[model samples]
Target: MIIIVFHIDSQERTYIERITQDTAEGIKTLLKNDLEKRITSLSEQSKLSVISSGMSQSDWDAISKNLYGTQYGYQAIGWIDSTFHVRKRIPKHNNEVTIDFNLALNPPALLTAIKAQDTQQRAVTMPLAFIHGDEGIGIHIPIFNANTRGNKLDGFISGVLLFKPYIKSVVPDFLLNEYYFTLFIDGHKVYSDQSNQPAIAYAWSKSSSYYLQGHEWEINVSPNDEFLYIAHYKVMRILIALGLFITFIIVLAAYTYLFARSKLKDERYKIEHLLKNLPGMAYHSSNTINRPMILVSDGCENLTGYSRAEFKKNRMLWRKIIHEDDFKRVEKSLNEAFKVNSPFELEYRIITKNSSIKLVWEKGGPVSSIFNGEIIIEGFINDITSIKEAEADLISSYAFSDAVVNSVVEAVITIDQHGLIQSFNFAAQVMFGYSADEVKNKNITILMPTPFCDQHDQHLAQYLKTKQTHIIGVGRELIAKRRDGTQFPIHLSVSEIQNHENTMFVGLIRDITKQRASEEQARLHTEQLAHAERVNALGEMAAGIAHEINQPLTAISLFSQTAKNFCEKGKLEKLPSIFEKLSLHSRRAGAVIERMQLMTKKGQRSKEVIDCIFMIKEVINLAESEARLRNITIRMTACDEAVDVFVDRVQIEQVILNLLRNGMEAMQLNTCDNGSKIELEIKLNEDKNVEISVTDTGAGLAQEMRERLFKPFSSTKENGTGIGLSISKSIIEEHGGHINFCDNKPTGAIFMFTLPIYEKRSRE
Candidate 1:
């Protein structure tokens, strides 16, 4: 009994062993293909990195931004005989701060490539040796320069593939299963699976091997023991069936002698009839060369498309009927089964009479005659063509679905109705720095920060009860947490999907950090452009400013001379008024220069609650010079009443000055009796905020000008940068104010802006 049971167990073990070996081969092929492709890609990128090191900075920058057109992620560097040097790298985190490949002494492949001219090589992985503790696998291409004498090796261009994460990011998540794997570098093991044990290939493990440019990876994969439990159960069932068969045979032989000859013959015929009506053929073959099919049921001809006589005569023999590709496997399995004296179940393809193929399963055991040493093989063979085809279709459908999910660029995730994560794809793994293996069946809130995580269950509960949507259907920007506990912006869109007995939430998420960064960068560029325009505006008004200062200086000089003359002639009465005028002129000149200086300076200054009256007066003073030169008389209303408003001083002044100058310029096109009056006003508005307006009696505005008034680079002035009004609008909006243009009374244009009131603490 023990021997028989062992026989059954051993055959199943052999079957499982074969499955594990095949799985290893497949894994090996996949890994080798990926690694070799990576080597080739790095080699090509190395050439570019080398050649571009001597190119101009701009060209290098463009190429680096594109990762040198390589599909995989690697940092490229050029190698002089002594050291590794980077020409450029982009998404620039990979930029090498230090150059030290130590290629002359380590990673023999790099040295080999360096020895030859323009040769490419792949080298062993070195742990945390490059750029932020990353496993760097060296791929080097020798670089050359043609001198006056001959072409000589200039250096080697090297690309260091950040190996670990690169592999994680490229390989499908489904493939990273429980199979224990060890990645060997040269002959030394550098990486292992989650098992973490350094294991050599076992009889059950699968191995993948890759060798290129003197570097290699021998990958061994051993399927988890749990994966073979089904086979173990099948072996138990076969052993039980064999035991019962022997017991029945012993009982039948005793009964056969007791029964009459006719009764025995009748029972034999009844058994044969029962076997013939079964789903498959029942057969007993002689254990001889050619394995002659001496007896077979009627179903044999139906399954094999051969007549009963043909099978009995061994014309269309069992061995010859097996498909060519499956013949060796079937034969090997049978040999192993017989060696263990076990019953075997095998799947093999058979060629039919019409030359079509049919998949079949054969279950058989060796039998020996009791009276003599005669040996026979008895078995049942069944056509499993439809079942196999259906299985293939099912597998194909699963593959298709997996492909679609993996192809999506977004980090797709699915969670159970209870908020536990059910699915996570490759993108999700890359985005969160967590493998699916690490997070599967974990709470979806693991990807969220404090408040979101805390509130997630409530949100789902609320949704289930109310069926109202907040974050469903629409994509909204939110912060997501990574495995490292860092937060990043993600655009999340989620929907409810029903899965048989439960509800699941499918979330489509995308990292929007780069997009937000780009927006911020654009805003800064706009601010810089505005500052340049302001400086340019200052330049345009230089002559007018000089004229305003010259008048004050001329008045001061005249008054001083007059006072001196009075002193010389003993006329002291006229000196008092002259000194007063001189002091006023100096104050006026200083205020104009100071306001101009503040407005033209670069960058943002902190906002403050500035006095509205004071600000209006200063802006008018700055523009007063240009206003007079343009023949525009400045008038003010409500200039003395104190009102405070919160704003950036320079930015606010810039808006006011721009409005004043624009009004003055407009008046240049329309001259009035009072020389194109420009009115500057400051007062409290209905909103209890400070309102400042610049009104002009110029040509006012054309319909088109009014429409595009606050648009950047939209101008009517001959030498206008067209940035002033647009910048003013931006500043006003940023300060929580709104600026607008409207008709001034009946004949002019008024450009007005309002600033929020500064809320001072009320007296207790």
Candidate 2:
């Protein structure tokens, strides 16, 4: 018995060892594949940089900025002069500084490749070190000028790599911790990972060397013994127990043989009885239902709640036992089986003696009757009532899921792994103007335009190969084609689900055509309202602007007449001075009218960074004549300082003019006994914002008027369009500012607004 058990144990051990060896080999292959793939990718990227350097100067200039340090590793590229001085560096230095390649190159990495100057286009790697205070690993690919046949190397496309991240990214930390590993490049120890005082020792190891891009990497690794022990511990115990049980059974074999002869007869009789009393009904009946069954088993009691005697007497036709709905199905199945002489199997419902329905599966075929030599139906019936109940519940759930798909407003579509449409819901049918039957088995590209349609298959095929997805599990805005060939913007979100053997994608799409149209209309309406406000402001100040221009015209006329008089009296010597005065006033009148024309220009608003103080001073100059006519003295409290804001200059000027004119009118409505004053003030606030305020001395605004002052179409003046203050509020807010009301110190309303200071960030 001991010898027998020993043989079994040896066989099991051999099989287990073969499986363990296979697993270890598989792990080694996977690791080697990863290392080679990553290194090959890095080598290809270096060559691409060399290619870009040869293309054009602009492409070369942008190399450093485009380098992905976090994704790939730290890197740099430069152009070197014949003197070995770095002439251009990507991700430029903070200040003008030169890198002397003569000192930066160590014993033999980049220096050897540069000095070789051969046309073979080889790559060299340099160790990490600080050259002028920056530490990095450099890989130099020599760039030779393409214009000349044997031109000297122009420069190098350098790769600065972070060692630890670059190495572990290809072979992760988990792999390092699980196995003992050492890596060498060019006979130098680049990285070595091993656990000291490991739980188990390494009993075996594997070593390999790979050469890539003229560089050699040697790798040695060994599996962890403790992990292998834990993996096989329970399996060994199970096999040992099985071997012991088999040995015990072998020892009892002789004793069991002696008792078997005596008990065989009695057991045969019992087995015969058991065979006749199986669960489910068995029957042999004639082809005609009116004939009595040739033989029926006792299981008819459980199957139909009727005795075998009732079926043998032909008291009821076997066809009448089938449920009403399933009568035709059962007859059809039997007819097909008889015609082909094949096995008959069917699932249908039957009515029991108590009028209760029980789902049953019947299986058998036509056989020759042993007594009469006539064909007969021989079959067994199994009660499948529970299975039928489960099917009913599943059908109910399918109905609920269909209801949900039909209720959604957005189009929902499902596609198979081949990009063929599998399910198109009601919304999708309506959106694409195609029914589910029309689009079924069609590729999803039919609903998309050129570039998207062409690239979709490529994207899907790549994902199937690499298991990497960019558009799946995200929402993207794209253009979709309708049945009428019209293209419109749609928001689409796709999700992937993997079921058993196939993959499926579900996409939800929403049409955004109306939404985009509404946004454009709103923007156009805003521009039209701002232009109208500028025109209205110019209309209110027309008389004052006329007076302002007439004064300059009057001066020019007086100066010209004086100059002519002097010429007539033979006083040509004074003519030069008079002529100078005439020229000054002539230019001044032209300036006034030009400013007015700019303020009311009918066009789109243009935004730029302008000095806020200078613009306010200009508005003040434009409104002085009107203020003086109303007996209001306009004063600038702090107009000399410089503050910059980004805004539409003309629109901002109109806002300032409207406020000053509104203040002057308010003062006139409630006349001040000591004369009215409109003062303009600007100050830089603690929050780095420009605050401008217009104050007037008059009867203050009523509590009721203050609440609705900025609301559209609510105004204090009868002739006012009621949109000026509202439009002013919109303009200021659009420029990243807010305008509102404040109480003046001496009992009047002050209109105050704040604007963000312009910040220059293009360089930073």
Candidate 3:
């Protein structure tokens, strides 16, 4: 019932006395003698020793109580059927377990060691017990026994028993049964029946390099095989299967896509047979390719004049075959197409092997992405020489036609069906006082005066309706007003000109005011010379008539004188009648002399400004006697407003009188039953020109004679001189005007003369 303990370090035994209450030798001797006797006595179950010995009193007392009964003679010994070594459970970490012992001593007993073969056979020596030696002072240690007591014996011989190694050191598994078993899973508590029990010690069984005599022992279970197996095994298996399946699908899809793409490309190659034959032609833009070229057409040979073999030997041959001037342009277009990813087509000239140039048409577009580079360009080329030549010829022809139009002298203007001037020549611009830029698109009627405003439009409508052209075919001499509001005569010859498919009119215009003026002056000059000659002859003829009439008058006078004397001697009234007859014969001789004198005088003066209507009235008055004799009425509507004109009054009046006499002669000479009527019209025109017209209703002048009516001696009268109208023109034109002869409606000729009016000076 007593416990004894000792701690000894044999390597440092100098401190053993301080650690232990007894000396080493003294304790050894006391334990060998007295401790043995006491132990024998205890084994014999006798009374305790009371002699003075090497042991302490407390030790003696404790040992005595454990072996014998107490002082009461009460028996303390008891026989047990079974002995159990209740050990504390070991803790597991990784795959091992550790048992920590809490004995009452620091050093356990040392003794001879023995070996156990297996776990079952080694159980008897596995559990340890405490024992005292023969010394009076004894220490405690372990014994390898399967059964042991846990009374006051635990105060000594305390050491570890492990079911497995400590996971850090190697220990015998037989001795491990000294400790209790425990089980855990992933740090979760399971079974620990002896978690709080003390660890049972085992005695050193043998002296071997594999075992320690007085050291701790540990138990171990490998972590890889125990807890971790159940924890992550399921997750690892699922992940492995899923990864394998995903890898299979990815590989299969990649193979299928490559195979399909290859088949599609092969089919496309057959369709583009021409593109495959050309060797140097590239699909993508590169100098060389392990892959086949794209869009290389067979016609490439014809275009470049180089065989496929020659180009394949040198990939740059295709570029060399292109015309030098066109190479840059083609390269620029290719670059642009690549940048924009759009289709491109163009025509350019390319040089051939024979040093001849061929016009080639090229087309290209972008293709796809490759190896982190956009090196794709698709294109084709072919000859286009014929097409380009045709375009050039058409352009040349247009230029020639334009030259002809620009060179015309007359003011040529072209008008469309709408009457708008489309093309106006230089002359047309100048004549119309507008630049080509100003009037090219203006209406044709812009050159016309008002009221004649829409007249051109109406005329065009009439012409379109009637299918006849009055102004188109023939040149019409007409008067048109200028931009300055002055009237000028011009002859416009318009013709309908047709183009490739449309109808247009070209107006050829000329100014004719000068030409007409020249004709008038020539006619007057001829009339003046003819009139002078006729007047000279008429004077000579009148001289002969005067002489002949005077001789007859002398004979008649002598006969009348004799008759008068005979009547006077007879002294009858018959003498007075005879005298009256002699007086009448004297007056007749005087009238003949006066008529001859008037015809011989030829002192004519020039023209001056005069009142035209007043002059016409005086001329009518002079012709009145002749009109009355023919039973004719000469009517006059001379405007009462004074129409002052630049002309000779005498010559204009003479022209009027001759026209009146001619009308009377035509009436009498034609032997018409009703006497003729004459009409005279005079008015001042709005343009400051005077009009004097003499019209007769007698037989009209024939068209043929009217053409020459103003010529000298070109008259229809029996004794007429055409000098009167000729002189009238000469005088009127001296003041810058004109005379015109026309036929009056239904009959006679109308003589009309226009004289420039004299504008009076302002009174201021």
Candidate 4:
């Protein structure tokens, strides 16, 4: 009896030890999982709040309050700035003391924060005493500047984890009552449910270790007095009582057999209960054509919406529930597994009794039933519908993003912090003459030319280090190289993308080669049109120029003849005066010829600063002869101060001349009873710009004519080419000026134009 009692006690002790070990392991897992979730939530919040460069106090307050509201077991949640100052704390009624508190005073917390920044990862500090006299550990998650290129630490999202409340929340209620648990962090006892209880030297106890954030955590679990009495002493006393009631040998044999059978039944019951409560279904099935299930857990109803009895009664029901598209593959896998007597795992779709589809993952192996010595299948089937759905959603999102990027006309390229190409859209591939695969993972400098390619890395490094931007978020026209070793102009605009892991730069690029070509073509066409109009204007003024030149030539002829006659008649004294008149007349003719030549010259338009008054005077001189011949009196109004303007001399002169000639022609046609007159005025307007006006005493323009006045191919005169006014408008606009015509006070037309005043810096 003593030997039997000793053996029974030994068995009880073994079972108790096993249970404690499992409990300790469970507690450790729960703590680790809970801590991980909190860390992840804090990290995500940190990322969101720093999107605008730095987090405001209100931002921190909102984030901390939200976290505190959603979760429990935190003594306090707060934000710490880069300077180690605690800027904001939640549950402010009690935690106000922590506000503005510098973390530098707490060596452990400060070290943890520094470690988090250095590793760019979340970290936890050693156990410490909280201000409220609670024992806890601090967790720090580093926040970084999202706009910057590097992982520059902006601050930390920190939380104080109260050991007692935290551990109570994680450990199941049933476990707390049955077992005494003690938690240790780095060999320091931080929490214990029963402080008076003996340590690990006790017979029924187990210990497990968990590593988190550089801290070694240990959980020791031991059975309480009630559990110890039930598991060990009670069973031993009952067996001893039974041994005393019967003959020694018979009682010994009966007790041994009954105890073995009872233990077997209890173990079986435990396994069955565990399987029934599992999150997924477990099954034992016969290896037959339809794979009829011999046993199925209660979880069958939850997972498949069918009872275990239904699965057993209808052998073909399980086979029918498999999705049509996936049944064949499932069967093939099972058949292969049976052939090799090996385990098999598969993921496939199934339809529940309610006709709802689900994705399930199954793991099974062939097993021989002990009762009948027949091969059977034992397996676990878990519903994985949510996981599969999440995967599909992620894939669809990526596909949609890719479609949008590739469809854009502008090339899209993304590069990592090191300037290595990460993504190359279809447009980028076509623009750069390289395949997506060829450019992926290559340095962005590969698509740049000589100096840019050489300096690209240094520029990127500098931006990352200093967070100073030159081209990021700004557009620039730069040279880019193609796979064919050709360089072309490209307009590039870069933007930064930041996440917890790293920084990325997205560039929108346009190949401006064709755009540049088109602009050059338009410029050349404009120059041609202006030159053509200048020549045409000279043609129209041919008669006026000839008459003006004739006067100067005739005067020279008369002077020279007089000089010769005086010399012949011995009038030497008057000869010097005649020679002087001759020289003056010759110079007058030469000046007219030079001005005409300048007007006819055609070349690229070059702008320079010149006095507006002087330019207008030259135009009047050329038009004066024509004005007089047409019975028109020309008048001038001048400003006392010189008005300087930046303009092409020839272009401005052409515009002025065209307006003067038009005024003369308008008056000639009207033939007013009062002698016709044209007024030319140059003065500064309110805007400090040079304003030139020409007024003609003729019939003013009609409403319809004014609307299309500046348009090409529209004119009001009888023998007009219709291009003079259009060319004049273009010339004025090109020189940063505008021309418009308005009605004169009484039966006349007034044409006014304004030119921007040139500053000295503009000439440079």
**Candidate 4, residues 620-670: lDDT per residue as tens digits?**
888887777787788899999878888989889989888888888877878
lDDT of 3 at 748: 60
Question: Which should have the higher TM-score, number 2 or number 4?
Answer: 2
* Candidate 2 ranges with C-alpha deviation above 4 Å: 1-74, 80-135, 138-339, 345-361, 366-436, 443-445, 450-478, 490-519, 538-700, 728-764
List, residue by residue over 1-764, the lDDT tens digit for candidate 1.
78878887888778777876676676667666765776665456555644533576576555444544555555553443524434444434445453443444444444455445433234433343553555556555555554425555555545566656665655555455545656776777666655543343244666667665456667766655444444576568676888899999999998877786679779989998898898788988876545679689999877888988999877878877888899889878777777888898998899988788988989998888564767678899999999988999999998997789888888999998899998888889999999988999998888999999999999999998898999888889999999989999999999988767988889999999999999889878867976887787788789988887788889889888988999999999888898899999998788767767787777756888778787777777777777767767789997455788887887787777778778777777666632477888877888887888888876768888888888888998887888888888888988889999898766778899888888887322
TM-scores, all candidates, are: 0.39, 0.52, 0.32, 0.47
Worst 10 residues of 2 by lDDT: 94-103
Report lDDT (CA) for all predictions.
0.74, 0.75, 0.53, 0.86
Ten-residue segment with the worst summed lDDT in candidate 3? Answer: 201-210
RMSD of each: 25.0, 11.6, 64.0, 25.9
- In the range 680-705, model 2's lDDT, one tens digit per residue, is 99998778799999998777788888
After TM-score superposition, the amount by which residue 288's alpha carbon in candidate 3 deviates from its true location, in angstroms, is: 11
Q: In candidate 1, which residue pairs clash? A: 24-206, 28-208
lDDT of 4 at 618: 90
- TM-score order, best first, reads 2, 4, 1, 3
Off by over 4 Å in 3: 1-320, 342-347, 360-407, 457-468, 479-487, 499-501, 519-764
Off by over 4 Å in 1: 1-402, 416-419, 443-475, 479-488, 494-505, 542-594, 604-618, 628-649, 673-676, 680-693, 703-712, 729-746, 752-764
Local error of candidate 2 at 87, Å? Answer: 5.4
